[model samples]
Target chain A: MYRLFILAKCDLGYAEEVGEKVSELEDVSEVYSVTGEYDLLIKVNFDDLQSISDFVQDRLHRVPHLKETQTMMSFRVYGEDIGDFVN
Target chain B: MYRLFILAKCDLGYAEEVGEKVSELEDVSEVYSVTGEYDLLIKVNFDDLQSISDFVQDRLHRVPHLKETQTMMSFRVYGEDIGDFVN
Candidate 1:
């Protein structure tokens, strides 16, 4: 599987809403409303690069109030917590 | 000191230029032209939280082509290479 981080911008006051919608998508593993340059940070796991690219270009870009997006392909993830244990 | 991660978006094709200007800022430690929902990822160090916020709200937001930004204040950063040994 491929792990990708998507940094997306939402219209002011829509960060939480965008995060929730992206989280509910089939291949999105996790999403967070974070601070800094972008409003939302999304973690996605996909079968291949094409799947990720397709989702970003087709579905995500169509979301209302979403202004722009940046995608970071993770070659190696060495952070302490990859994802929060939400159980 | 505080280390901050800012995810910011630039108008298409301006990522590299914005990255350069941001890198030239007094306290900016590093800046990267990254892909995903946001166009840029910047690592900034400041003497205090006020400095960081002030830079973001006052200076960064004024950059002509900048669209938006989200900031993630690092409580603990555990990556292998904190900063590229740019030597």
Candidate 2:
């Protein structure tokens, strides 16, 4: 699978609601309200690069109050949770 | 806790080693070899912003062949994993 790390900038006071709305969209596995230039970070899982493009064009753009988005697509996932460190 | 989403650019062929070394460090939760302008994406957790600064200055900067770093600090985490969708 491919993972697209999206840094989203939403309209004022819409961060929380945007997170809730994005999380329910297809392949969006995680969402966080974050500091810095972006207001939200999203993890989107899909089969290929085109799917990611489709998601951005089809679903993500439709999320209300979402003003801007920057996606950092992953080439490979190196580590996961605490389980990785377990012996 | 505060979460810093770091985007790293590493020297050629050093991405895998960088990921391994970073995952062993303190407060780092996940590492991914990613596409786009950056080579790696890291999730770092700490008590405050100061700790995030320290990690960058004290530890992350020391990783071999790691050329650049960009941190996107998180204000709050909204959703996680499949369990969130389960009833």
Candidate 3:
């Protein structure tokens, strides 16, 4: 699985609702309402790069009120808790 | 809590060792070995932005063989999975 983190900006007061909508989307593993330059953070898993492109560009970006998205493709994970992984 | 995702590029062939060292750091939530421009992905939780800055610059960046890092800060969590939360 590919781990992708998307930083998103949303319309004022729409973060919570946007998060709800985003979570329901296919391949969306996690989404968060956050503080910073971006208002929401999305985590997605896909089978390949093409799958990510289709999901983000063709589908995710179509969601209303999310103003912008910056995608960061992960190369590897270092500190994932072994205990957490076990559970 | 503040959520941060860090994309890291490392020297060739050092990913597994780097992952082990990173997992031992304080406030580090998770890390994954991934594929892309970067070699590892790091997730960290800090009390505030200042803590993030300190940890990334003063502590994390010091890990050997990991060449560079880019950070993304998150304000809130949207779809972190109720079941995951419940667990």
Best model number under DockQ: 2
Model 2 RMSD in Å is: 4.1
lDDT of 3 at A30: 75
> What tens-digit string does per-residue lDDT give for candidate 1 at B1-87?
556777789998887677777777766754555556777766666767778778888877777788888779754322122232210
Question: DockQ for all models, in order?
Answer: 0.09, 0.53, 0.47
Q: Which residue runs does candidate 2 get wrong by more than 4 Å?
A: A48-50, A79-87, B47-50, B80-87
DockQ of candidate 3 is 0.47
Give chain B TM-scores in order: 0.81, 0.86, 0.87
How accurate locally is residue A66 in candidate 2, as Cα lDDT from 0 to 100? 97
CAPRI band for model 3: acceptable
Query: What tens digits encode model 2's per-residue C-alpha lDDT throughout B1-82?
Result: 6778899999989999898889889888788887788889888777777777889999999999999998887776565543
Per residue, candidate 3 scores C-alpha lDDT tens digits across A1-87 of 566788788888888888889988988877866555787767787678778888888889999888888787765555444443311
Per-candidate TM-score against the hidden true structure: 0.48, 0.82, 0.67
In candidate 2 chain A, what residue range of length 10 has the lowest lDDT sum? A78-87
Ranking of candidates on lDDT, top first:
2, 3, 1
Candidate 1, residues A6-82, lDDT tens digits: the string is 77899988876776667677777545555567777666666677787788888888777888887787542221222
How many angstroms is the interface RMSD of candidate 2? 5.9
Superior candidate under lDDT, 2 versus 3: 2
Q: Model 2: how far is A35 from its true place, Å? A: 1.6
Candidate 2 lDDT by residue in tens digits, A27-59: 777787776788888887777777778899999
